[model samples]
Target: MVRSDSAGNGGDAMKEHCGVLAIYSMENRPVAERIVKGLAALQHRGQESWGIAVPGEPILKGLGLIGQGADANAKKILSFTSNRGIGHVRYSTRGRTTLENAHPLDIRGEFAIAQNGTIANTEDLESVVEKEFPILGSTTDTKLAGYRLLQHYRAEHDWTRAFHKLSKELSGSYSFVMITHDGEVLAARDEAGYRPLCLGYDPDTDTHIVASESCALTALHADLVRDVQPGELVSLTKDGLKITKFAAASRHYHCPFEYTYFGHPSSKIDDHYVYNARRKLGRVLARKYPFKADVVIPVPDSARPAALGYSEESGIPMEEGLMKDRYRRKGSLRSFIEPTAKSREEIVREIITIKPVVDGKDVIVVDDSIVRGTSSRNIVQSLRDAGAKKVYMVVTFPPIRHPCYMGIDFPTREELLANKADGETLNVTDLNSKVAREIGVDGLGYNDINGLSEGIGLGKDEMCFACVTGEYLGLKKDPVLRTREEMKA
Candidate 1:
């Protein structure tokens, strides 16, 4: 396996996108403080900006990490005295990385919404809004969706009805935590459950928590309530919890990337332990792409569990082929606060140390996913320089070809390695082959889509495989979709 030289040496880390945390106090206790704490735990998900919206008060937000002075903003927000609030920590993957794009986007009367997925048909949606409701600010599709909903809700004057209408019109993946002015906290998962949203309980305070991961609830000593089922709308109000179903029923395609990369190791999604799922994926890969190697070296952190499972399944010893320097800073200190491609490359080069054991050995590298092939290419080059005799790469997920509108940040089609080349040029017959050649590897393998779905204990129909297969299940062709199709044509 290839290694990122910058694993342990702490320059800057590759960060995932935004995390959403919402809390509604059943007993009307001070909820803002709890929301702040929960967002702190989820800061690993997104680090660029943080915001919180409390009823009857102005939304509070700013640039930078959640802990670094974000607590002060939370404390300030706590002064609002609202029992229902939605908080967001953003990592700008699509829109401009600016304060305007920071979330917990509030509309005056209808609602305030925080979202975790990217809107793939944003260009189309934006056109509809510009012609229909032209007063909206910010470039994010999230804000556009919020305004569209606000417009619908103002006319309908019913939260559930407005949401149903908006869901029908929206395209792409989104798990939303929305707060209505009527003091209702509504949580809706995307039709395919592409982004994670779980429910939990704070027994002592009798509060209800909804977050992108279970780990946030655990940090606040909350009990696991349940995962918000796909295509389900959960409403929490002073009355109680209520569920409303919408959209055409289809199989849930939960994002496989969650388990392989984005999800926290301690979290559980769709009832399966995330870390355990990765290990199972590794085990499945070993069975499907068996290779005789002297050592199984994980790509580090994200790939560790799969590597362990691979070693156990292949009867190969797992060795730490790459040593991470925990203390070194790679580039400009400011870049760590806001990571870029240049910063990430520098971090990768600075963080890893090669082990003597891999110098003369045949090695198998296990990784979560390969997006553009650049990171994997760098890792492979680093390993070759470290004296590995042979390097084989294995990915836990299939090649990603399509851009994700439901929130996973994949490059556009033209930039995807699989989309750009045929089997011969890519070197392998499948995803594994394309990745292997891109990174200059002797052999490459990827877990088939079925293998991945089954390894996670989910049936093919129960998970969102859109990113893997480009087949959207519940998406409807509304005005936005139609207009976008016309524009493209």
Candidate 2:
């Protein structure tokens, strides 16, 4: 287990939840190898710790990148002869970044559990257990939820019934996968579907896989069967998959941020291709906030597709005006998830401004979204230093005016630029101008809520715009941001 005494702030922008994967092999073959691959593919969702659990063996877990973390137990984990097991890679939205808070947590030696998304009512979930069970102290929210389910399983002696009980009582978002001591795999998505979970199959190995994204499934060469429906539970055995709906999805509240920035462009979520959605987002921005520029540029990496769409729609040639310092070991790391302002700045500074492309040109820089204006400020200043005549910003997602509790980190309103405006009542135009000034850009235009929905090609009501609209669909009650000291008490 990896231990850290303290962790930095979760960057200056939006950080996401963990990634989860479960695999079952009919032939009882070594599944860890494939699970590792799938988890590696999903590593962008998390970088703190990686864990895997199989029946009749002690679960293996490590900290940092999966490849380096798994070095010591590589052979042992790789040789595990198990037919079914669950794996997780974590980027904590709850608790501290410590081994004790890692996922695939063992539950009373009878089961192991891991999940994606926050349990807004995690404190309340603990009430069902007997006092003798001890308070779920010094553990993450995942453990709180798992223990809650354990109480039900102990009474009913059935995973299905336990899940039914959990789904009914639990609040907030999750896509849970658990490994039973009996070597069966169970997967579920919360009713609101604030997170993505998909079912995939590997025909050659006769394996059933459940993962957080289609990219991970594609990495394993597994065919994506479909996304697990909201409020649905799937039980996987050698026989096949058994699906049960524990609740009704009267209205689905999928996260729009997934398509805009959090999701891998190659992945598909909720029946929409992420890459296509991103292109549409750029086109929408071009149409809504048409600006004449000598050339178009993207903020590297995630914004590349959006930049392409902007160029196509505006008839302006797109150029790689910014390039990541790929040669450096830390250069390729994502700045948005760096966990500290200093660290995020270090990574963002590594993004070199391609002077030849933007020098003396009126540049339109396309980005996925602006969280607190930290990285955007850095990028815009770099363009000025590189002799760019003008820099205009186009963001795919709307201004994140409200903190997100369902998932997609940045839990406090104070850290949000839109929310931090002089007053809370400024409209989009004034808010954009204020933010543009803060970020040192000539001008800025943000995709509105309606534009965001249209870009993703999903109905506004069917998506969670809570981060922008402040209307939560999955929260049972208004969430309170608890202090760590208070939580420890």
Please tell me which predicted candidate would have the highest TM-score against the true structure: 2
Q: Give the alpha carbon lDDT tens digit for every residue of 1-489 in model 2.
A: 211222321121122278999998887788888888889999888887888887767777788888776677788887787777888988764334666556777776667888898877755755555353664443456667777888888888877677778877777789999987777789989989999999999999888899999999999999999999998888998788888887666788999988988888889999999999999899999998888999999997888999999999999999999999989866877777666677778988999999999999999999998887789999999999999999999999888877777767766777788777652587889888998888988889988989988889999888988788777766767776644344334
The candidate maximizing lDDT is: 2
Misplaced by over 4 Å in model 1 are: 1-17, 71-80, 123-132, 323-340, 423-434, 478-489
Candidate 1 residue-wise lDDT, 273-309, digit = tens: 8889988898999998899889999876678899999
TM-score of each: 0.86, 0.94
Q: Which stretches of candidate 2 lie over 4 Å from their true place?
A: 1-16, 130-132, 481-489
Report model 2's TM-score to 2 decimal places: 0.94
Candidate 2, residue 293: the lDDT equals 93
lDDT of 2: 0.81
Question: What lDDT score goes with residue 129 in model 1?
Answer: 69
